[model samples]
Target chain A: MPELLPFAVSLKGTENAVRDGLAQAMACLAPLHLNTDDAGTVELVLAEALNNVVEHALASTPELTAIEIRGSHGADGLHITVIDCGAPMPDGTAPLAKTPNLDVETHDMPEGGFGWYLIHTLATDVKYSRVGAANHLSLQLPVGV
Target chain B: MELTSSTEHGLQIVTVQEPRIDAAVALAFKDRMRDTTEGGIDTVVLDLNHVQFIDSSGLGAIVAAMKNLAPDRKLILAGLTPTVDKVFRLTRMDSVFGVFPTVEAALTKLRA
Candidate 1:
């Protein structure tokens, strides 16, 4: 632990609160000289993560779930960790995003496969861990930038 | 997030004046865009100046909206913060939608 700042927030993952919490985190982290976008990026990623927890992670069980985000700075890079107290992913799901359709092909049904895609695209590094029914996601960024 | 749209020289500029559009609000975003397009607007310029974060669901919703308007109308994205830009680039969405430095720039190009 290289002097990390931890933030813990509990909410219904109602989208708006997740958005605000992400903004608040960015405001606190980006000022450290990590060039982060003040736009829909955070909202998109956090929304997906929070939603997964709210819908599938806890399966609407209302287990008094909470998300813990941690940020730290060091000579290596900027570290962001999101921890959710919920169920593990279905069998073998990981943090990596699915393959994107790059051929500009038309779709019969225009839905699915965009959220994690955007998250994987924006985050320099992402890692997911399931520890005894907990989803621990960490996103990192280069500090030199 | 509430989406407000107005025309600028025949261009439909949709502005989302809320903080975030994560998964919970992603469907609302798509619904609003659908309503905006169904209202007879063709060209769209999505303004994300007020947004700070966009999770996977949020990004998916944006792409979904663009697809919904495809082969008929076009969608242009504007006012992407550094994080937002990174997301697009990483997901290769930089190629999916026309991105602009500002809304005015996107409109200018569309008019040209």
Candidate 2:
């Protein structure tokens, strides 16, 4: 008998709780025998997405914030789904992929706004949808490829 | 994040003693960097040789630390792991800062 493929975790969407979520996700991934780089990719992508939800989406409604993280192994690689009942993307629009403005002088270098860029770059097949009150984000990473 | 600082060839080298610079310690890392770099030399080299991971929050903290420095001061990075290096390159932050292969290289550039 083998274990399950898709495992889900429901947690309070708070910045403080992200570490625990990441740990749990890693634990679930431990059996998959992902290499260091692949594992890091998983961790970083998940962290960025979860942090975005906690920081931006759940910023105001901290009381009703609930984040669900689910991971399943697919033929391509590992698949992650993050569902959160937080604020929709401002103006009812999904976030588009935009590169950070790096063409700046030393004095004009940016301090933040690198989160989504990293998320979009590192994860493959990233999709975001605002479903009713929940934001559903799907991302995948191919292992050893 | 824990850091140890020293002055070498007129450049301040701050070594991050932690392995990961994620959201948990990004703020504290920035604060310590500010305190360390305040009223110091104009050029600072951050040693990330020990750091194997850096998320966007960590990157932002580094950028903030750079901004918090006194006028004309620069923050340079050195000894990035492959994973961490990719993060910088992917976000194109590599273009904004001078990233060296080693602390020595960063210092030599400063010295030269």
Candidate 3:
């Protein structure tokens, strides 16, 4: 089984449309026999990434900014890579650090924590990288999805 | 999604329809909660059967409702599918809100 299938979508504005792209990814991976627990894991990882675009990936620009999504799935689990043209990451918050911990809420915490935090906990591997001008986040689910 | 409420055994059950519950609907959801409760109905229950996605703010709105309606009333969450459950858990809303499996179950428990 070739472990690579790709889906790419470019969405405009910070609408709920991001969920559609993600739901597609989850739908594709569902037939691969990932049990109930891992299925929930996949859903959270994708939702958090799509959500980042809605809340933080845009600036004072017209409400026309779009999110780019590229996803793939296979026997070892599903992998969805989200590429968003949001504000430049903050230093170490860049490339890929662990999704900040949202388990403990604090006043100084930035909007960046919970999304990445849930993605990190739900997936066996979560990586964020800045490529060109986009923030690319790759989330891996263990166990062939 | 629109949130509608009704009281059963002193429990206010708020039904939320639609797939995503985020910033746009968060306020409206909260308002309906307050409005209904202020109308002499407390013990709120949010029915999330139709809600497939919920963000931090959405989760926050629910939490806010709890704080705003405490003592006199409390918010209970019901029908959280796996996706919504994960959001609630990751955000720790699950800890703050009393979660139930169904609206009927929530009503029963709240009344007890």
Candidate 4:
């Protein structure tokens, strides 16, 4: 059977939109025939990446913001690019993925800040750039290789 | 987010009925958790057997639920699927929470 070519999904910058977009994106990758573990990895990475755009990049102007997710499968893996017409990443760069301090007391445990960490840990070749009025973040998942 | 709770062996076992716990329902999940766990039970066991996927927001909501019951009550996790377990392990939150392979195991160990 012939593989599905590159796919794209456009969504609004909202939580529900991200969820629906992810579902559509996963459906598009159905042709990849990824194993269970690999499929989970792809889902996780994409969720984190898209969530960041909705939460950070589009936080200020969510109503007017839009996100685009594009993906293609290759011998290396599944490469995904998330683009948004929102604010550029702080200082025009992606935040460093630092493991939060988990040794603290239970009351002081972090309730957030794990998004980038998960993305960086699970996805490779993560790159961020500001093209004109849009922010482009791309990464590769080591699946379907 | 939909959750159901029942008392078994004096433990409040709360089960998440949804499949994906991502940013979309993280807040709702946290609120539901708080409402479901508001009682005399000091230990609550979260059964995630039906949940197949969880994002960082969901992970953070779980952590928040634990913190909301900290110092007096406790939150235990059970029946983590592969993706859910991966999130917990990658964030090192697994070490923070007492995880069991099944709700029965958690109940057995706690009841013992």
Candidate 5:
């Protein structure tokens, strides 16, 4: 199959923005006709990645925060790069994708800290970088190959 | 964040009427769950058949809901779609809850 043109979606750094951006990104992938599982994987990974930007990277920025998502499908898989004009990751690195401990007591169970884990588990080649004034996250979802 | 509840056979069934339970509504969903399941039956079944998508935040809210009813009441999960099931299985949270294929199946097994 021929290569599809890369699609980019610009969004604000907000929860509702993430939701709307995800819907548009998924719609852009419709041409690939990805299976249900693949579609879901793409959507979930994007949601987590974008949420990280809105909640963490852009947390302190009260000014207008801009987030851009670019995606392209190829033989290897779907390549996604999320760019944001926000604070660089702490220590200039992304947090390790460690799965939260589920062995704790019921009341002590973790209610958060699963975003990066899900992104790492479902997506491959996860990379994070600080480019000047922006944070760039790129990953590959093994779908539509 | 529309949740409908009904009680049957001494079990409270709470159904999520929305298509998603992501960050956009995670907190609201959690708060609504606390209100809906407050002082209900000992066992609560959350129906997720209509929900096609769930992110980590949404998963966290569900976990919070279950924890909110801890040591007294219990929260069970039913009608998980494939995508939602994938999240639970990947996170290994499926082991933490009594997951059923459908609400009917959950009610049958829980009633027995």
Candidate 6:
């Protein structure tokens, strides 16, 4: 299926690059005519995906250092694909979503591990694959559906 | 992220002036929040009315800030935009933190 108004950007796989990728992705999403709520959804989901690349994939393979984000809006909804020539997913599978221990004691609350949880919960049609030495992740978010 | 703080009803309210809080500023945000919130009232309310977006890192930063307060102080979040609020709810952090729609509401609750 052909994508509507496709946009893509490539940068180093680092935290700063995730920031830049988010900005560029926002620019790409500008013309998609998304409502404010949908835009915010895409932004949050995209940030989580990109930041995962920076923190896990990129951290593992500093030598394999290119992160590419490609996205488009179409009849289905907003679709995003993040490609990184960095580390593959552990066990070659997307991490299972674990509900954080929300009912913990005051002193035992968790400070992290919410990234994949939000990504899985917010985005639809989420997928991850390892192609050779590259990691490919794709996510879709509906526009006012 | 630019943050401002004030005291209301014996609770410290800190407002985040930035629209987005993500990996880019999570560390800086935590450090600055620690500094701004250090040595104030035992209870603090984070005002995020201006923050329209937050990622896992930003959420973790807020949690980290809260944990940094430790056994002595408390951290609450207020004025979360719908998007930010959704993230919190989806991640179940809403159950972990006391979230209010407005700073005044949080202050009122804390006072009572």
CA-lDDT, candidates in order: 0.68, 0.83, 0.67, 0.91, 0.92, 0.83
User: Evaluated with TM-score, which candidate comes out highest?
Assistant: 5
Docking class of 5: high
Best by lDDT: 5
Error of 4 at A88 (Å): 0.5
Instruction: Sort all candidates by DockQ, best to worst.
Output: 5, 4, 6, 2, 1, 3
After superposing candidate 1 on the true structure, give the runs of residues whose Cα lies further than 4 Å from its correct spot: A1-14, A27-33, A37-48, A92-95, A108-111, A115-127, A138-140
When 4 and 5 are scored with DockQ, the better candidate is 5
Query: How does model 5 score on DockQ?
Result: 0.89
| Candidate 4: tens digits of C-alpha lDDT, residues A1-145 | 3276999999999989988898899999998887778889989999999888888889988879789999987878889999999888878788889998999999999999998899999998899999999899999887887
**Model 1, residue B11: what's the lDDT?**
84
> Can you give the DockQ of every candidate in the order shown?
0.47, 0.63, 0.29, 0.87, 0.89, 0.74
Please identify model 3 stretches exceeding 4 Å from their true place.
A1-4, A27-37, A92-113
Interface RMSD of each: 3.5, 1.7, 4.5, 0.7, 0.6, 1.4
The window of 10 residues in a row where model 6 chain B has the poorest summed lDDT is B37-46
Chain B TM-scores per candidate, in order, are 0.93, 0.96, 0.86, 0.97, 0.98, 0.96
Candidate 4 wrong stretches, greater than 4 Å = none
Q: lDDT tens digits, residues A26-140, model 1?
A: 5655445433352234444555666666667766664466666666666665666777777777764554677677675644423566656656765678778887777888776
What's the C-alpha lDDT at position A134 in model 2? Answer: 88
Q: How does model 4 fare in lDDT?
A: 0.91
Question: What local lDDT score does residue A115 receive in model 6, on the 0 to 100 scale?
Answer: 80
TM-scores of all models?
0.76, 0.89, 0.79, 0.97, 0.98, 0.91
Task: For candidate 2, give the lDDT of residue B9.
Answer: 86
Show model 2 residue runs off by greater than 4 Å: A1-4, A91-93
True contacts kept of 5: 0.82
The DockQ value obtained for model 4 is 0.87
